[model samples]
Target: MNIQKLAFVILLFISFTICSFPSTSYACKCVEPKSPTKELRESTAVFSGKVIDQLEKGRTQFVLFEVKETWKGLNESQAIVETVNSSSSCGYEFEDGKEYIVYTNETDGHLEVSLCSRTHLLSAASEDLDKLGKGEEPSEQVTLDLSDEDEPPVWMMLSLLVVGFGLAVFYGIKRVKKKVNK
Candidate 1:
């Protein structure tokens, strides 16, 4: 119940609260089910093909494509059309032997795409976050280069020196007062 003990307990409580705050996470970074195949999940490639086969592989449904339009950065160059049971929020429907465009972007090496969108079809125009990884350079150019010898911006160094001098003066006065008290 002493003041020092109460202050220590309060400090400990504050430290614990600050340390326990929730951390941020990216879902795409996690590993996915084996059956779905990493290629089918995070590929940024696009190709046109007919859905020739569809089936369930383990917990995941897959669809095969017979590639017609070839492009760089997709799962593969080509495959005979096939369909497997799959679901997505991007509004793509699969039917046997139907010719359509297949767009895939893999997250954590898992495939995802906005099916049937104009942007998806135009591979060059893809704006998916997966395609453009985090911390991308802004398209606009703005440069503020500081020279190697550039002193800390004058104002910053001045303020810091002022604070240091103030602390020194405070301690000096305290020492003088203690000596006089003695």
Candidate 2:
């Protein structure tokens, strides 16, 4: 019957879709990291700081740091550095309350860190610290919060509204169908 052929076609399409699009993960491909001296020269900000707070939104992570020492670029006591949300996305994972010597580059107007950067936990950066030599305290005090950094994307807000509207319409249709069947 025509219905059997239609069912077969639908099944074939589903199978093809599933087989064609296997689950995939992004893998970060980075060139070998440079030396601390070379990396410091390439950076927009180089400082040792403790992570105070972090906020993840979509694919971006905003990290707030309390700056302890400034070797280059940073003049403020507080700085916010942005990174990708995943290691697969080349993001460096910064744990809360942990001190780190961070190297960041200016990317698209934001100071961004990556797994490829010459950044490390404070405890692990002794050799780099010795090579880096003297550091000065941050001169200016500035406060930055994760909330002040990002607002939800307009497309995300619109997509949510559309999904909510669709669900309400589907519920109304189901109720109408049930009443008609009664």
- For each candidate, the alpha-carbon lDDT, in order, equals 0.46, 0.87
Worst 10 residues of 2 by lDDT: 1-10
Question: Model 2 reaches what TM-score against the true structure?
Answer: 0.72
lDDT of 1 by residue, 21-42 (tens): 7764322222332221233344
Task: Provide the clash count, candidate 2.
Answer: 0
* lDDT score of residue 90 within candidate 1: 33
- lDDT (Cα, tens digit) per residue for candidate 2, span 66-100: 99998999899999999998989899999999999
Distance (Å) between predicted and true CA of 64, model 1?
A: 0.6
The residue pairs found clashing in candidate 2 are none
Candidate 2, 4: how far from true, in Å?
Answer: 16
lDDT of 2: 0.87
How many times do residue backbones clash in model 1? 22
